[model samples]
Target chain A: MSLFAVQLRREWLLLVQSSEEILNPLVFLFLAITLFALATGGGPDTLQAIAPAVIWVLVLLANLLSLEGLFRRDFEDGTLEQLLLKAEPAFLALTAKILVHWTFSGLAMTVLAAVAALILYLPVSSLGTLLISLLVGTPALSLIGAVGAALTVGLKRGGVLLALLVLPLYVPVLIFGAGAVLEQMAGIETRAQIYWLGVISMASLTLAPFAVQAALRVSLEQ
Target chain B: MSMSASLSVSQSLKAWWHKLGSPRWFYEISGPWQRLFGVLALVLLVTGTVWGLAFAPQDYQQGNSFRIMYVHVPTAIVSQSVYMLMGAAGLVLLVWRMKLADMVLSAAVPFGMSMTACALFTGAVWGKPTWGAWWVWDARTTSMLVLLFLYFGLYALRQAIPREETAGRACAVLALVGTVNIPIIKYSVNWWLTLHQPASFTLTGAPSMPPSMWVPLLINVLGIYCLFAANLIGRLKLTILERERNTQWVRALVREVSA
Candidate 1:
């Protein structure tokens, strides 16, 4: 197989061996959704009204929580430096790493979000929109979060700093992602929101890898 | 002969930019500029404030509360421009590895942060009289809030990293990333809502308000830009001195000044 495939397999193996990396964000998502329901007295009417916002916010937070480990382990083991030192460019390796990150955190969260939505009383009609919005939106989140993770990965206490660096960038994504679901529930056209979300995701897919690579280089220089 | 002349002109332009990239050169050249900008800012600001607050006609709609526009509009306008300035500095730092560009980026942050805060505060105070609330989720207001958060992100990131050059480079990446997202954030937030009034001045049009109003507003804008420049240069000189304290020239200059 090729080098990209080799890197992909390596990241996959590493994640599988340490499955809790996948479980932590998933647990956070489920628990937060349940607690939100309990705290709000589990009223269907109120929960349904705010379900989209709650789910989207939780997903964004869970994605951030997962990001604290995205590059930290690799950096600690010196794998990141070795990967960057290769004769081949690091973009493909970085892409594999981000893809694996999204698969475990963003994708898994989207699946759990459907369950969370049911628990929160989101209308069945809005379910498809939520799923589709998350499908398109979370890749951009992973990409953007990787930029933050790479920048702070070399720091001793980078977890909180990562959130501060990445959260402002997450605003547009949250606005449209949740806005799309909210619009669908209100019987408005959601095409614009989804389209904007797609534009953001595609833009980040193309741009964020270069930024992540630059950040990693900066981190390594120290 | 014309071709050689054009080539020489380009070479000279390149030389000028390279000279500007030198911290020592900037430190030496900016002393008089800082004084000039300080004097100009003071004169213009005082004239504009008195003209705007006292002499200008009260808004038939807003009464005297309209005078706060003299502060709100300029700070709001300059705050965004400073972010753009830092973004440009970030580009220069990343692409050319210019140390002075990093200094520019670092020095501008606190000033820009305060300007953003001043704009938001003035906006809230203005809003209390106009919108009947101190804060509203209006498009302009929300976007300015996001701008404040972006500034904080850069500030916190700079503080988190211990090594100066590493921190500078990392902040450069973050600043560039923020710059790219700024237009998207503005567009998205604008699409979300727009209760804030349209701009008073546009490049393609004459003043929407009377010249009596816009003239003072224009003066305040110019005054604030001068203040921003003076502040940036002063902070930059201090940063250069601190960073270069171990160098021979800086020591000599310190001795010369103290003696």
Candidate 2:
């Protein structure tokens, strides 16, 4: 197999073999959604009104939680150094890591977001839109968050700082993702928001790996 | 023959330029320019603020509250431009490994954050009487808040890293990344605001201020630019001294000043 395929397969196997890594964010998302429901008094009307935003914000936080360790294990065990030096361009290796991260975290969060949407009383019609938006948006979030992870992996206190660095970049995604579901709720056409989600994901998919690479190089140099 | 001739000419030019790249030369050169701009900023700001506050005609609609625009509008403009300047400086730092660019960036972050704060504070104050509330998630103010967060993120990232060089490179990447998001943040916030509010939340839509009113605003804008320049250069000088304190020229300059 090409090294790229091997790297991809290896990453997937690692994630699947360790079930806790995949389960944590899903559990966190569920608890956060419930907490939002409780905090707002659990009224069906209120939950319905704020469901889209709550889902998006909580999904972002869940994504942040998962992103915290995206590179920590690799860095600690000396795997990251080998990963960097072994790859030719290093871009593919870096991107493969981020893609695996999305599969484990972003994809899991999308499914949980759909379930949370139903629990939060989001309209039945909006569920598919919510799922679609999350599917398109979460990969971008993971990519941006990966950059944050790469930047801060060397620092002792990176958990909260990671959020600060990543969340601002996540603003546009949240705006449009929530907007997509909200449009469905309002009976408006949902095409523009979805299109923008695709655009953001494409941009993130292409550009963020370079940033992630730069960040990793800096951290490792330090 | 032509190519070789041009190459030597460019090499000589680059050699001369390299001398100016020294922090000491920058310090010495910026001295007079800083003084010139300092005086200019002070004089224009005093003249413009006094005129705008005490003399300009009241808005027919907003009344005296409109006067705060002199401060709000200028700082807002400077805040965004300073971020873009940092991004440009980051490009230079990453490509050329210029220490001065990083110093300029380091000095600008706190200033940009403060400018963003001033804008948002004034914006809120302006909104109180006009919009009947102290805060609105209007596009402009919401996006300004995001800009403030971006500044905070960059500042925190720089401080969190232990080494200076590593921190600078990382900040350059973050700042460049943030620059790309600035427009995205802006447009998305605007879209979100309009989608939610569907009302004309703009304060300065019409150019109805007649030159008597706007000319003071114009003066304030010019003054703010001068102030930013003066402040940036002043801070840059201090950073140069701190970074180059070990060098003999800086020590001599320091002794000369102290004596």
Top lDDT model? 1
In Å, residue A44's CA in model 2 sits off its true spot by: 1.6
Write candidate 1's Cα lDDT for B78-190 as tens digits. Answer: 99999988889999999999989999889999999999999999888988977788987777788999999999999999998899999999999999999999999998887
Q: lDDT of model 1 at residue B12? A: 100
**Tens-digit lDDT string for candidate 2 (B17-44):** 7866677778878988988998999999
Report residue A174 deviation for candidate 2 (angstroms).
0.5
What DockQ does each prediction reach against the true complex? Answer: 0.84, 0.89
Q: List pairs with backbone clashes in candidate 2.
A: none
- By DockQ thresholds, what CAPRI class is model 2? high
Residue-level lDDT tens digits of model 2 in A1-222? 376777888788877887888888889889888788889999999999999999999889988998888899899998888888888778787888889989888887787776787899998889999999999998899998998999999999999999999999999999999998988899999889899989999999899988898889889999
Poorly placed runs, candidate 2 (over 4 Å) = B1-9
True contacts kept of 2: 0.86
Chain A vs. true chain A, TM-score per model, equals 0.97, 0.97
Displacement of the residue A39 alpha carbon in candidate 2, Å: 2.1
TM-score of each: 0.96, 0.96
Tell me the TM-score of chain B in each candidate: 0.93, 0.94
